[model samples]
Target: MTVGASVKQTLANLKGAQGTLRTYSIKVQDESARSIYAEALMTTNKVIDDLNKRLKTIELEEPQYRAY
Candidate 1:
């Protein structure tokens, strides 16, 4: 319900989704397709990491207010 809790939940959800996508990519990528899959996975992971970092930064930078 709180902003901090919401941010934490969102980060956790992103991480979970990232892990699922990574597993699926690895399982589906063939010998010849591995390179493409790896590239996509890397890009996706980087974005997820960036998002999580931003969420944390916001959580830290913003002052918590009393919930009415």
Candidate 2:
């Protein structure tokens, strides 16, 4: 679809990935593996936040993309 819809979908996918990483972090027994998952989860969270800000900017700059 449209750019807005595509970005929203990508955001959703990233959130899903974050959830999976969190679950893995909780379940894994190895200390190094847990640390790696935690780091990945943190990075994913940062990307999600940045993407959310970008989405807001996009909505503001392109009115047609708002609320979708």
Candidate 3:
């Protein structure tokens, strides 16, 4: 696929993951579940980092297609 499409998909995936993380955070907060919260936070952070790296690579390759 093209760089733009790839970047869009990656960003969508990252947003979905962020939503999931937020949900998990709320759940953990309400239930006072530290273990689950920590796990979710770690996973969320990793996904975010990967997404950022991929986005940077895409931007470097195609500087004209900026993501909002």
Candidate 4:
């Protein structure tokens, strides 16, 4: 696949992981486990945000990728 497509796929996977982390954070009874999941979720969120910005820049730089 193209670079843009690969990045988009990675972003989607990260988002799915974030959702799973959210669920785990809420459902688990162990306080330590919950805290760990929360921290991981926060880190994933930051990466997602940075990747989204990078995707925007990619789209801007390569108009052809905007539709994908």
Candidate 5:
């Protein structure tokens, strides 16, 4: 697949992982585990945001490669 497509797929997978983390955070009973999962979810969210910005830059720099 193309670079744009690959990046988009990675974004999708990250989002799915974020969802799973959120769900686990809510379901877990231990406070420490919950905190860890929540922190991880936040980090994943940041990565997703960064990837989105990079994707936008890529699209601008190469319109033909736009995958969104």
Candidate 6:
């Protein structure tokens, strides 16, 4: 697979992980566990944002093709 495709796949996986973390945080009764999950969620979100920015940069740097 190409770098772009790999990055996109990673972004999707990270988003899924973030959603799972959020759900776990809400369901867990232990305060510590909740806090840990929340922290993880925050980190995952940051990573996702970074990946998106990088993807945008990559898209801008790569050439586009058009068929006339």
Q: For candidate 6, lDDT tens digit of each residue in 1-68?
A: 65776888899888988888899999999999999999998899889989999888777776352111
Total clashing pairs in model 4: 0
Highest-scoring model, lDDT: 4
Residue-level lDDT of model 4, residues 1-68, one tens digit each, is: 76777899999999998999999999999999999999999999999999999988888899876764
Q: Which window of 10 residues has the lowest lDDT sum in candidate 1?
A: 59-68
Error of model 6, residue 28, in angstroms: 0.3
lDDT of 4 at 15: 98
Task: State TM-scores per candidate.
Answer: 0.54, 0.92, 0.54, 0.93, 0.94, 0.89
Residue-by-residue lDDT tens digits, candidate 1, 1-68: 77666766776786777677677667874766666667777876787788767766766677573222
Evaluate all candidate structures by whole-model CA lDDT and list the values in order: 0.69, 0.90, 0.74, 0.92, 0.91, 0.83
Candidate 1 has an lDDT of: 0.69
Better of 2 and 6 by lDDT: 2
Q: Write the per-residue lDDT of candidate 3 for residues 1-68, one digit (tens) a residue.
A: 77767767876887787777777777665555756776777887787787778877877888877766
The all-Cα superposition gives candidate 6 an RMSD in Å to the true structure of 3.5
As a TM-score, model 2 comes out at 0.92
Query: Which lDDT tens digits does candidate 5 get at residues 1-68?
Result: 87778888999999998999999999999999999999999899899999999888888888987754
Off by over 4 Å in 5: none
Cα lDDT for residue 8, candidate 5: 89
Which is the better candidate, 5 or 6, if ranked by lDDT? 5
